[model samples]
Target chain A: MKMHNFNSGPSILPQEVLNQAAEAVLNFNNIGLSLLEIGHRTSWFQDVLDESRSLIKELMQLGEEHEALYLHGGATTQFMQVPMNLLDDGETAAYCDNGIWGSKAIKEAKLFGNVNVVASSKDKNHTYINKGFEIPATSKYLHYTTNNTVEGTQWHALPETNVPLVADMSSDIFSRNMPFAKHSLIYAGAQKNMGAAGVTLVVVKKDVLGKIKRAIPPIMDYRIHIENGSLLNTPPVFAVYVSLLTLRWIKKEGGLAEMEKRAKERAEYLYNALDSLPLFVPTVNKEDRSFMNAVFVMQRPELEQPFLDECKKNGMVGVKGHRSVGGLRVSMYNAMPMDSVKAFVELMTEFNNKNL
Target chain B: MKMHNFNSGPSILPQEVLNQAAEAVLNFNNIGLSLLEIGHRTSWFQDVLDESRSLIKELMQLGEEHEALYLHGGATTQFMQVPMNLLDDGETAAYCDNGIWGSKAIKEAKLFGNVNVVASSKDKNHTYINKGFEIPATSKYLHYTTNNTVEGTQWHALPETNVPLVADMSSDIFSRNMPFAKHSLIYAGAQKNMGAAGVTLVVVKKDVLGKIKRAIPPIMDYRIHIENGSLLNTPPVFAVYVSLLTLRWIKKEGGLAEMEKRAKERAEYLYNALDSLPLFVPTVNKEDRSFMNAVFVMQRPELEQPFLDECKKNGMVGVKGHRSVGGLRVSMYNAMPMDSVKAFVELMTEFNNKNL
Candidate 1:
């Protein structure tokens, strides 16, 4: 079966990236060495680290005002590290709790200092992002999750804040074009739209670091990796290599503007299909639907299994929703082809006509 | 040209494992989906996680007395986490400063509590492991790095401490059959003897957890990972899979007993050859020479580059000494075939004859 992968992270990557990564693992750059065996300090792997960082800067249009770093640990680790570096003891940081990721960031920040939840969508079960929410001028920084993968909501606009802005763009980074200048720090786990799961991409305005009162471990310190060129320790070489390849793919496909256009189109196609169908209900507030992940529920609960079964039989994988909110979630990341979306819509239409 | 990888870490992995990993990245398990794109929450990946964790336990001979955790971050993170979870706010922990890793561990530990250096090889420039060292009886735990990758020294025996023993066995793990039960906590970064960088293997005694005064982050708490079965967050799935394959490879090739026997033979073969050669001088105390990484300097300083050139032309990689100590280091890890050692010895002999 020619399967269409819609799994939310560790999700679909460019086929070209996969091919290149496979070739490298077998014999990297005709060196007759497996990528797994290459020394991290060697020039070949160093090129990978350099180019990956460079590409991120280019793709995001980050200027001299920002510096990029590749660090181990994932987005979850960043939840604490962000505060540990940026906020001081007893200082306050503002967070907008729109979903699970936002709440997690808020929780971790509280461990370092006081956190004021500037706004929350918890009252509405996170079905809608509460825009026009206020950010306190007293806070050291304002934090938010740009996209909620689990809850299927994404911020359509940047929150206005006088304080330094920090965003965890883990699930939707590079899928759209956003104003990069508004944020002091932007971090994303590479597993979703980037490449693999081992490395996290952190872009910070260099001047924003070194203010915290706590002794941050070297691995946790963004400044250490930035100064050492992300080679302070043995990095996850293969993951960064694949990420570079994916970044190259994104560049070749006309950068983030094209990616955003394609993503919006795909999501619109799926949403249109969902609205036309009687059997399914798109779950999130329509205005806040995520272009990255589209969540829906079956109107007739008993029909859910058969619909999933038919989709699987027709070569769909990872469409099942997260356990916390179950139904269906088609994660249309950047690499998910338009044809795959069309096929999914076709399946939905056929199922609706036959069973409605 | 055929390259022989001997880069202490991110080092040699089995060709078969590499092939399998490469294939899965393209299309996993004939599922017509790339492993890079699959949902970690799915049954497919969960199976990999389960078997990998199980294999580590089986290989380490760890039963219910200890639980193995596939942790994020690296061994460096554990340097703080071990004390944070194990020691109270004011309690002191004993540490042996064998080399760089030991020093780093002690530095991170100090962030959480007091650290008492029971013994140190620093007085001798870290070229020898201090024997007959005593652990502080009043300390909460005793910590040591079993093998110094940089200085090329290994502990022949662990300290007899009544307190819980914590070993950073990052470099020498799986190279020998050590007393696994002697330590309550053993943490290793996977890049050295295991497979790749990114994932860390932590074996913690179940009873020793839940005693710290500080509030550890969810990712920092070993107990949370243990309870969640190491799936508290999306792990470095590919790295863990590679480590699992390496563990299986070790088991199939006659387990740790056979591995130890081969490691000893390879180390002895190289050391004996170095002893007979007049051009090179071994650095560490002969009694404390590491079986994993063998460090040596040129008898005449000018001959260093020539010797390195000769080795490189003969297909040796990663023989360059660490910058802290300028000399050659031949890391004879578990996966290094005996023929490679034989080849290295031959090169040494030829170079010695030319220099003399």
Candidate 2:
């Protein structure tokens, strides 16, 4: 069966990326050693690390002022480490409570210092990104999630903030055009559009560290990693290698500019079909709906399983919504082909005609 | 040219394991979706997670008291987190300073509480594990490194301590018989015998958590991971899958006993060659030499480059020692064949004769 992957994360990778990664697994760059077997310090593997860092900077148009680091301990770990490194004991960090990931970040930041939630969407079920939040003068940074993976909401524009902006772009990183230099730091877990699930990509301005009073744990501190070129200790070699390959694919496909164009096209196509189908209702607030993830619900609650089964019969995977919000979610990340989204829309339409 | 891999970590993988992982990268278990494309929550990937956790327990002969966790953030992260959960404010932790890794752990543990250096080998250049030091009665846990990659040292026996024994078994895990239940916790970075680099395997007793007065960051807290079955957040799917394959390979090759036998044979063959060679001098103390990593120096410093260049021409890789320790170190993990060791031994002999 030709299964069309709609998985949220650990999600779809391009066929060419898969082919290249598979080849590397057998024997990376014909070095007579599997990528799985090479040490991170080896010259060939160091080339991988170098290329990955270079590509991220090049794609984002980041200048020398910005330093990018590939690290272990996924984005969740970043939630605390970001605060642990940036926010001093007495200082506060402002945050926006938009969805699950943002809330988790807020929880972790509280452990380090005071967290001021300037805006929140939790009351009305997180259908929109809260806007026009005030950043406190005493705050060291303002943090937010660029896209809510579970709630299907994305910040289409960067929120204006004075104190250095930190965004968790885990699901939406490199998918669309990003105002790279505007933010102080961006951290993303590379499972969605990036690559496999082991590493996180962090881009930071080098000068921002060392201002804090408390001592940062060496492993968790951003200064040590940046100074050592992200090889302060052993990193996730295979994950980062796969991510580098994905970055190459992105560049070959015309970088994030083209990615944004294709993403917008996919979203419009599915959302139009959803708007026309009376049996299905898109769950997210349309204006704030995520281009990366399109969450929708059946008109009749009893028909959710049948619709899922019908889609399953046609080789659709991961159309099921998050358990917190019942329905279907089509995650159209950067690597997802237009044909897959077209097929999913057709499935939604055809299933509604038969069962509605 | 076919290279003989001897890198310390992210080192050699079993050929079958490589093939299996490569095939899955393209199409996992004939699921049509690439392993790189599948969601971690999917049944097949879930099966990979379950089997990996089970095998670690089954191999270690751990029963109801032991709970194995496959987590992100390598052993370095665990260096702080282990103490974060176990040690409290005003409490002290006893540490044995064997080598670089242990000292790194000591540095991280100090952030949490007072650390009493129970023993240290720094006086003798970390060539052997010091003994007969008293572990403090007020210490929360006694921490040590089971294998020192840089120093080429191993603790042949677990030290006698009244409190729980915590070990960083990053290099020598599953290669020899372990005192599984004797320790309260054991952690190893997966770049070694376990699999490729990404996840860290943590085996903890379920009831030992919540002993600390200071609050732990939820992501760093082992109790939450245990409660959620190690999937509190998205894990390193591909890394864990490869690790499961390695675990299966270990079982297919007759479990830990056979691993111990092969490890011993390889160590004896290399150590014997090192002892007999007049041109080479073993760097580690005879009583506590590592079976996994063999470190030795050329009898004359002037001949180091000539020997290294000669070995490079003859398909030897990673023969250079860590920069801090000036010599050659050959790391032969579980999947390293006795044949490769024999080939390297021959190379050492030929180089010695040619130069002399």
Clashing pairs in 1: none
Of candidate 1 chain A, the 10-residue stretch with the lowest lDDT total is: A210-219
Q: What's the DockQ for every one of the candidates?
A: 0.78, 0.82
Candidate 1 residue runs with Cα over 4 Å from true position: none
**What C-alpha lDDT, on a 0 to 100 scale, does residue A160 get in candidate 1?**
79
Q: Cα-based RMSD of the predictions, in order?
A: 1.1, 1.2
**Residue B221, candidate 2: how far off, in angstroms?**
0.2
| Candidate 2 per-residue C-alpha lDDT over B1-356 given as tens digits, one digit per residue, 9 for 90 to 100 | 77888998888999999999999999999978888888777789889988889999999999999899999888998888898899887889999998888999999999988999999999999988787788877788899999999999999988987889899998999898888888899999999899989999999987678887887888889988988888888898888999999999999999999999999999999999999989999988898999999999999989999889987898888889998887999999999998899999999898888877
lDDT of 2 by residue, A60-142 (tens): 99999899999887899999899998988778888999998999999999988888999999898998877776778777888
Report lDDT (CA) for all predictions: 0.88, 0.90
lDDT of 1: 0.88
